[model samples]
Target: MLLAIDTATQAVTVAVHDGATVVAEHSTSDARRHTELLAPSIRDTLRAAGLRPRDLSAIAVGVGPGPFTGLRVGVVTARTMGLALGVPVHGVCSLDALAHGVMADGERTRFLVATDARRKEVYWAAYDVTDQGVRRSDGPDVARAADLPAHLRGLPTAGRGPLLYPDALPHALPQLDVGAGALATFAMGALRRGEELLEPQPLYLRRPDAVPQSERKPVSTA
Candidate 1:
């Protein structure tokens, strides 16, 4: 069994996949409580599925292009559990997981998967989903929604970022809002296939929302 966790966005998703088939899954959109809620949810999902931590073959985590706090919460939890349970922890790109969620079986098409990155920018990726599964075609980049390239205009798109930023959506392709379950499913497939797992790291494509100390101005007295 493969246990997967995704706290890459506001949503917190957990799933138990027995190879390609998902035996159980749970998720909720609680941006403020990911730290407090994730562990209990994981326990409940596994208990509901009649499994234990040691029963899992591996653990998968969404190494994110997400906000720092929530992204770290998921990765840290996964790492801690992997260490305690002696299971290998695998990392999956958050955008790849979102694309997997949107893809329909046997439909070969290009797509863009996006997630909100606040400050009016988005974490985005382009993909092609064929019978073999989703393949990354373009970046997992951080870009302003209004600056989306012309080539991406004709492809199908999904995720909260695009839905939230409708002005960026072109008329040529369909758009859908997919979530974390798809991510968990996709990550499970990668783990089962013996894919090389990347080191867990936050995909912060741009600078964080903080000013440098040197850039700060000092207060003056009259």
Candidate 2:
């Protein structure tokens, strides 16, 4: 069994993948409650699958180019569980999860994936469906939709960016956000193929929203 979690977008998704297929999953959309929702979702999904943490052969998580707070919650939780349970944890690109979600629906051979990056920008990647799987063709960068190359903006798109900026990403697909079910399925397949997945970490494409306050000079009363 494999456990997968993804919090790379507003959605928090947890799923259990038995050897052949995903057996159970919990998914919800909440921009502010990843920390709150993730743990319970994991517990509930495991219960639904009739499995324990120790029963898992491995763990997989989405390493995101998302906001720092939400992204960190996922990576940290996965690593902590992996440590405590003595199971290997692997990372998948959160965008790739979205791409896989799209491919599964319609098998679009080529397209784009973009998620909200706040600050009027987006975290975007282009993908090509290959014999092995979805291959990231370009991007995984941050920019406004209008500022992207024309080909990218015109590609059939997935994820929240199109919802937020419709005109710029007109060919939007129905699936948005990284689905943990898809994330797990991709990781398991890769492992079966002897492919190396990423280390469990956040793929923050830019600096975080919060930063240290500028140093202030001491006030001398003398």
Best by TM-score: 2
> lDDT tens string, model 2, 1-222?
999999989999999999799999999999899999999999999999998888988999999889899999999999999999999999999998888889888877789999999998999999998887789989789999889999899999999989999989999899988888899889999999999999998998888888987898899999
Clashing residue pairs found in predicted model 1: none
Error of 2 at 43 (Å): 0.7
Each model's lDDT: 0.77, 0.92
Clash pairs for candidate 2: none
* Residue runs of model 1 more than 4 Å from their true location after superposition: 105-108, 170-180, 210-222
Per-model TM-score versus the true fold: 0.86, 0.97
Point out where model 2 deviates above 4 Å: 219-221
lDDT of 1 by residue, 1-222 (tens): 878888888888888887757888888788889999999989988997899998987888888888778888989998899999988888888877777776643365787777788888878888986667779989988888778887774556676765777767553233332344565677766656877766766666776677477666877886
lDDT for residue 41 in candidate 2, whole number 0-100: 96
